[model samples]
Target: MVSSRERIKAFDKKLLKSGEYSVILSRLPAYIFELLLIVIATSGDKLSEMDVFIVMYAWGLTFYIAPYLNIWENRKNVSIYEVLKSLPVNQWDIFKVRVEYIAKLLLSRFLIMLGLQIPGFMMTGKILKENMINSLAAIGWAALVLTIYALPGISNYRSNKQIKWKAKQGGIMWKKM
Candidate 1:
């Protein structure tokens, strides 16, 4: 039997090998483009400092929301989660590790968004340093709100068994079977 420590390490390795990360990497450029478009469309001639900051914070928060939603909605796509579920490892441990992984991913995106904001702040004549606190606070609020939305989906996934999918004339749908 594998020890808990060994299982944890293996789970981490599985996550690394899963190749699902490419999804995030591939979408990154589109994210940047979309942000730029939003700025252009909304600002017209001038962009407000607070508006740009809100956009930056929102883009940062999307990092967390996207991954967690992917995990909860399509758990099977993440092979590490499957292995962890099958293993003797505590479910809570699996949950914690997944949460940590999500947080790490979020931070990476947050930093990238912060970097992009530099040019934006410069263009708007807003000092990034001066507005740093407010931007951070907005990021924090985004994280909190997204987390609140995620909890129910995770809990529902856990409490229910045999999640089922059905196809209709209109679209694909899922429900607890």
Candidate 2:
């Protein structure tokens, strides 16, 4: 008998496909990478300081927004409120899954980049001096922003569930300041 971990692995192998990643990656800031590669090629053998700045800028632009994509995705294609109000599972599960997916996808992308960067950094250790602290700060700030954006949807879902439950018991839900 396969263990739960094996089952999860099978499920992931089925649901997470290369084509799906291609779509997700396309939605991300691929253009920035393309531009960086072009500049590197034109430089004729090595990247310069400006190349490092460009890479950092690209990451800065994309990193923060990565965590919040779930919220944006939901906003663009909001789950039906009417349907959610009737579901048996707690309303938060839907938001939780979305946020989880975003985190997973972002980490996947980050891992891929880190895999590539480790080799590149090894080759030119000088560029490694770029402020790691700033990148970390950006990540923290972006996560905070993503969480804030998600709050509204999660709150909406929770409020809807509470209201539906109260109505089922013939009680009115009230909002107090």
Candidate 2's residue-wise lDDT over 1-177, tens digit each? 755444434443453453365436544564565345444433332333344654454454443333222212311322233334464444455445545554664455444444444556666563533423333333344444445444546545644555566556765443321
Clashing pairs in 2: none
**Every model's TM-score:** 0.50, 0.40
- lDDT per residue for candidate 1 within 1-177, as digits (tens), equals 776655766755654457477646735754774466345423322333456645565555454334433343353222234434555677556555555655665566456556666677767766666444544554465556445434534544542432332233324354423
**Per-model CA lDDT versus the true structure:** 0.50, 0.43
Mark the regions of model 2 whose C-alpha exceeds 4 Å error after superposition: 1-83, 127-138, 152-177
Lowest-scoring 10 consecutive residues by lDDT in candidate 2?
A: 70-79
Under the 3 Å rule for N, CA and C atoms, how many clashes does model 2 have?
Answer: 0
